[model samples]
Target chain A: MLRDITLGQYYQADSVIHKLDPRVKLGTTIIFIISLFVFQGAWGYAVAALFLALVIKLSKVPFQFMVKGMKAIVFLLLITVIFNLFLTPGEPLVTVWKLTITKEGLRMAVFLSIRLGFLIIGSSVMTLTTTPNQLTDGLEKMLKPLNKIKVPVHEIAMMMSIALRFIPILMEETDKIMKAQLARCADFESGNLIKKAKSLVPLLVPLFISAFRRANDLAMAMEARCYRGGDNRTKMKPLHYEKRDYIAYAIVACYVILGIAAGKLMPLLVSGIIQLV
Target chain B: MPIILDKVSHVYGQDTAMAVTALKNVSLVIPDGQFIGLIGHTGSGKSTLVQHLNGLMKATSGSIYFNGEDIDAEGFDKKMLRSKVGLVFQYPEHQLFETDVFADVCFGPKNLGLSKKEVELRAYEALKLVGLEDAYFYQSPFDLSGGQKRRVAIAGVLAMKPEVLVLDEPTAGLDPKGRDEILDQISRLKKETGMTVILVSHSMDDVAKYVERIIVMNKGSVMYDDAPREVFRHYQELEQIGLAAPQVTYIMKDLQDHGYDVSDEATTIEKAKEEIKSWFARLSAVGKGR
Candidate 1:
């Protein structure tokens, strides 16, 4: 199944990371991704990996559970690695007829793969630890200033949260539809690409129809509840930076500084080892 | 036996925090050509249990045997099983995607790799079995009424000519008349086709009237498996599990408790009427004796 898909999935548990304010967690994830790409050295990535491990442990989300989300992106990961492995021209390391692998290409491939993998895991951690409601509140609060430019921040955040919430519902719907089709002997997994794609006609048409139906129903329900634009709404549980959130923020700051220092010191250390050899 | 579940158990997301054992050690043998009703509250594993019959889901621990062979055994032709035991899901109308009702009904038979002529013959027969008019055949399924759309969806499965038909809450979300019509059609179709029918529903009244055997489920276990009269006798226990017997059962129970000469086994309307008439006869006999 399609239930294996964990898009915007939330795992609830009593832990320091789970208890942190949603805004703080969201900000930390963004900063973490920024630092992941900002620093280019092996030491920075090592520190990043260590930080991710520590966060994963604190969040109480099982490693296996988090890794399952990576299954969906295996193809994308492979494509990115292959592109980086062959496209970057540098001092040649391996050449096989038309395909050339250079030292820089190899290095780029490893780094890019690491970056992408870490990025996914890092974002997954945030989504896993935070509920969609918390995410919506965090996003709205963070984007409050955008309202000065009349950007409809609350509505945008509401739409995002609704979209996030509907993902699992739609996924469940797709599974049901596919099973219904499967019961009809509608094969989806076999045959050539064209044949497989043709098989999807039965599956996709219903999925699309159901998605639209759900959207329409949701719109009607919201309207029936007198949900006009988000003009003057007060939160029942307002977003406030709790004590754990401050602690998380401090830890993230320390991580960024450590990552930057590692990035700066890596060249010197590598050159020193090269000179000694 | 058309289907047999041997202490079957299904666990969703096993070993994870969100793990749920939807079906416990459920062992059941569904005899061929019996109209059985599976009554359970929401999430009572009724859907999961039925899906195992068609090989749509594999049990987490136990095994299911279709015609004496373990369905999970290696090299078992699961697709063939799926075709043989057609499952019409809840809100099956959502699966309707073909431009017209005729083509939609043809989908299952066409997927069965049947020739065009045979597929059409089966489709037409199925539509007729569901009591749809021939005029509705060429119309878009989307253009049909809710009840008609549901009938078309059922016809799609019927076209497969399944030996065992499993319907999951087929009449859910329909008006009372629509519900009755669908149930009546299903009952008629069962009698006509003699397919081993398993109706999964929460409605005691509906199942009590239509099915010969009723299987009552609660919390992933079959609490009662017997004739509707036998199952409804324990209305108190059924009520405890967020389910109720037909209204007539409680009414008869009330009469019985109040020292009336009414039988509490009147689980259906027709049976209740007979119980009342017989009780009136007994009353007149007592008057004559006095």
Candidate 2:
């Protein structure tokens, strides 16, 4: 059952998006997020949606997987839609009791929901296409300039990579511990909220103890391997940007510009009864 | 009741890139009231196969029958099946959590929604079965020694009154004395309760000492399943598959190679000594006759 966790799970595939430099993917994801906020109209949403679909197709990741990825944030998406639908006031499309659902409110709900959905899917596309090691390599390279500002960028990336590497191992350990508890008849499934939380004591105590033990062992092993911090450390596989990376960056820049222009030209959905006349 | 697995196969993370076939087309019937030993190397699908007995894992394809009834059938309580087929996982002492040993041992019967009186009664009985003292019952389980903690964990499962007990590496990582104690307790439990026991272990000596039948798994299939004596007869084949016969069997085979006329089926130390003594007696008789 723990295998259902999809977050940070990279699907290895031979596709153009998967082949792109991880730095380019990281930068493009950031640009895409900025563009999402800039794009306000249906046309802009269409462009962003089309771009995401193109990326998904290039990555060769299944549509059902993207839908599965979206499942984690479905509750948040629903909340955003409901909040925008009832809370935003304008020319009323429908009214019930004290709540007024306006045309603008409806538009806002759909736009915001789609925007948030696209934002999550687009960022996930980057992670799905890149391995954790490559992602950390890219992050360290991108943050190299921050070294001058004393940000310890390399150390942060190293920690992130280590954490990512241990996630599956830790998950397996947790699954084992849970099964052991279950064998002893620890009922985690039934009972009220308080009772359920109480049941977690058996699971959590062992998990925490084991996690700490693992951390200590990992630290000792790292020290034994002479893993002293980022000073004068040479990487076996250094990050090198290719021509394809530049082209990918240029495409993301153009998409962002088009999104900003679309936002400017699109008719603004005004609030209150100003649009009724 | 016999535990029957019919063409059972288990694929971990099916349909994903990380998918692996842990077990394939494995069929076996563990008859009731038998002490069955499951021997295999790491990742040999021994754990995966045993987990299906009590419904800890559902078969990817095929079926598992507990006492002639489909365990995966609708309305069949897998949890209750779990209580009936108690699994004591490796290093089970790590699962202890209650402030006191009594509360921890009672956890199983409590989950079964038994009355407080019944829970306490079963807990005390289980403690006694594992040879824990009455004073140790109210003390914290974590304060006990490693072997004692393991016994407490076992008692926690035994409190459920399981008919079939499945243990994974019950003696792993224990000192020799501790190991013998645990094995003796299990043997006593079987004799006293008449419960069927399935033990998963890597030690051929342990299996030979206790189990009536041995099942050897390699890769994902059962390579050999027979009486302990019969299985150890194919010593070379077992070694080729990365398993070794019990030390006594190896010694007996060495004696036979040296023309001592010892049987290859001598798997226990007592039997090997007897065989060697008989061979020496015959040798002395021949020398005297000459």
Q: Which candidate achieves the best DockQ against the true structure?
A: 1
Worst-scoring 10-residue span by lDDT in model 2 chain A = A265-274
For candidate 2, the per-residue lDDT at B99 reads: 88
lDDT of 1 by residue, B60-103 (tens): 98889999999999999987898899899999999999999999
What is candidate 1's TM-score for chain B alone?
A: 0.98
> Which candidate leads in TM-score?
1
Native contacts present in candidate 1, fraction: 0.84
Best by lDDT: 1
Q: What is the lDDT of residue B37 in candidate 2?
A: 94
lDDT of 2 at B39: 96
For residues B211-254, could you state the per-residue lDDT of candidate 2 as single tens digits?
89999999989999999999999988988888899998888777
DockQ of each: 0.81, 0.58
Q: Which clashing pairs does model 2 show?
A: none
